[model samples]
Target: MSVKRHAFVTEENSISCSQTEQTTVQKTETGSKFTCQQCGRSFAAKGNLKVHMRVHTGERPYSCAQCGTSFTRKGSLNAHMRTHPGESPYICKLCEKSFSRKESLKAHMRRHAGVKPFTCVQCGNNFTRKESLKYHMRIHTREKRFKCRQCGTSFSDKNHLKDHVMTHAGETPFMCDHCGKTCSNKANLEIHRRIHTGEKPFTCPQCGKSFTAKGNLQTHIRIHTGEKPYTCARCEKSFTYQRDLKRHDSDPFNCALCNKNFLLPTHLRIHLRRHAYARPYFCSLCGKSFRWLGSLKWHQKVCICAKTLLPEF
Candidate 1:
């Protein structure tokens, strides 16, 4: 008989994804005393067997107070709580970067170590994390396990299915403080906040330039590597960024702040800056200020008063 003793470790300030961690079970010489009714798995302790039954019953007893999201384990709830305030306690030793969860830090460590532990047997694809490998396996298996009860739509992951169902529900749970705009997910809200905060954390490896999102950094990295990852589904045309792909298809990216449309999200982000009072460029001769770099460059060439600033450049 195996007696699994549950040990709960809580982070001091931040929320972690790991919840209700169970340590190595203490195996006894005595025969199995506790047996799970659903799976017929025997355990030494009745409490261990009871918690294990949640797998069969699909019961998430613990829930977040702020988001009203439920979790099967207490540790998951602990981790989910950190997302609300954006507190990340888990930090990487090499780069000293803090992550919202320990698992995320562990995954980030792979990038520094160049570790590819998980491999796909079917396609020889390698991934840093096990969950990513499992996600990749769906490509080979064509597994759409997360089925939507409302519609006939299915997804490879639970979160994807959850997001798909929200489209039908039309519920915008996450909202922006600055623009009062709303989104379906918390991640989107975080990305939107970067516009107001002007926080660009993701930096280019080749260049010292930074961006608000990792996706933007990836697109910028493609510029150095000459990697065109985005492809048009209609004509099979490739693009370095998704915004370029949309632009090639004549799709306009619209700004919510002003009813004006642009070709890229970067353009929309820049367009949003017009709504805010941000003057980073200055003309030495006229003491004139501009919000954008292009405007200042044009002023240097066209404006006679901007002649003195050319020496600084």
Candidate 2:
């Protein structure tokens, strides 16, 4: 009886066979006839191998017509199409939260189950999803693959780069209904809406203080934890906030008339307005002027003179 041997090329760019007992040959077992030339991954069918080759080639044949998002597989593009029509077939029983895909619902279930399968070997941090672990690994690797063409700024996440790109174009699609204020992104607009609604969802357990945003809550927690992550390079002084460290490194903005020093340029500009007696803000009802907009708003609230004046058309 004669035995047939399978051969494949490896990372070293050398051809090796199963007779030589190479690791590449081990993967070619279980009757996987079709193999990927670039990654040495074996597949059962020729069509499967051809589809797998798209990973190395970065070829996304399946594209979304609604959002222009490209996917390697047809199934992935089909799953993405549900998002456009707000079709969420998968729903969590615990929280009643809906997801477009089954895999997303499965990952969300892990949070309820307290199951973290993916873990970083370097930091020992566990994540429920594989994609989350992949993004977290970039912190240790310092690999920022996504770069902005407009400002040359690099981001670890593609979504963050997408948000940063909008700043360059001055795109403020998300607007607040209360104050007519506009925000660059939907998340920022949601946070800005909390100010009008007086909603503080993130609460500090230690101090019992509440914050509108998660980032602000995290910063508030550092006050109790004494975690000063930002440090000044010049004086080696640490601060809880990056803005404080920047102020420590920067020269003080001095007032020419009073010789007073301010940490920020905006503070100095406001102080200069005091020296110049500049009252830019004025009340339309009473025709009363004030140095600051806050003062003008406060005076308008208590100003009974508006009652005596006739209404303007």
Candidate 3:
């Protein structure tokens, strides 16, 4: 049998003998082909070696016009352009759901077909995708690939690392349109927007009461479950939330304006309001103002005082 050989493509996409000479190819007993010069990964053909070289070289020739995201292959760039227009060419016949890429449709089809090909040898757990299995295997091996540039904290996944870095930087990318509030993540902002939209997605199974956030739903479920995650160190009393636990602590945080101490920082903030001269809330009836809403409501009911009142909040 004649041994099949092909010329390797250069960085410029031209087949060059000099580029092929850079890499060494050794055939194994099973007829393995080309090996990587850097990583020692074996490839069947010289063309595949040329494509795989981009991984080590960080060479991305293909780019999308919409987002300007570069890709190693031209096919990846073409698929990325479909995402800009929200165009899904591949449609599943089972549910008539659309996907931008064929691979996504295939993954979706696996969910309906109940097919899990990727399996972990150690745990014997099955996953729908290979990447899911790879992530799961990190638990057994304790492999952390992603590292923070700022804090030097390592994470197994990129998403967790991104979340950790946000705490260090105090970066709030997601913003609310109504209240001008900002959040570190999109999910938190989405939950905050529910306060305005009144859209409750998380529902309690026991009481049928709905909440804007899943955390709130989980906390509600804890009422039925009787699960108290937070506890006081001194009293050994349990609470549902951290705020409730802090509330039980007597006089921890102190007011900067006054010498009086409070359990919570929020109580200190309310105490500091009494020292401020600015009474922002104006009464239309008396043309007078007050600092606290409770004082204003009290003034509206009983007091016909002509002067502005800065009551002790």
Candidate whose lDDT is highest: 2
Full candidate order by lDDT, most accurate first: 2, 3, 1
Best by TM-score: 2
Candidate 3 Cα outliers beyond 4 Å, as residue runs: 1-81, 84-86, 166-171, 178-181, 184-188, 191-313
- Count of backbone collisions in candidate 2: 0
Tens-digit lDDT string for candidate 2 (93-208): 99988898799999999999999999988647678999988986875565799987556899988878767755655555668999999875668899999999999999998989
Clashes in predicted model 1: 4
Better of 2 and 3 by TM-score: 2
Cα shift from native, residue 18, model 3 (Å)? 41
Tell me the whole-model lDDT of each prediction, alpha carbons only: 0.70, 0.74, 0.70
Q: Over 4 Å off in model 2, which ranges?
A: 1-86, 204-208, 218-313
lDDT of 3 by residue, 1-313 (tens): 1124433222322222464444333433354466665545567876687776675565778988777777768886887778764678898999988889788899889989999999888646677888888886775555789986556779998877756656654555568999999875666789899999999998998999999988689668878877565655654556666566666676667555554668778877777777887686777767788888787888777764534453544
* Candidate 3 Cα deviation (angstroms), residue 234: 28
* lDDT score at residue 250, model 3, on the 0-100 scale: 65
lDDT (Cα) of model 2: 0.74
Model 1 gets an lDDT of 0.70
Order of quality (TM-score): 2, 1, 3
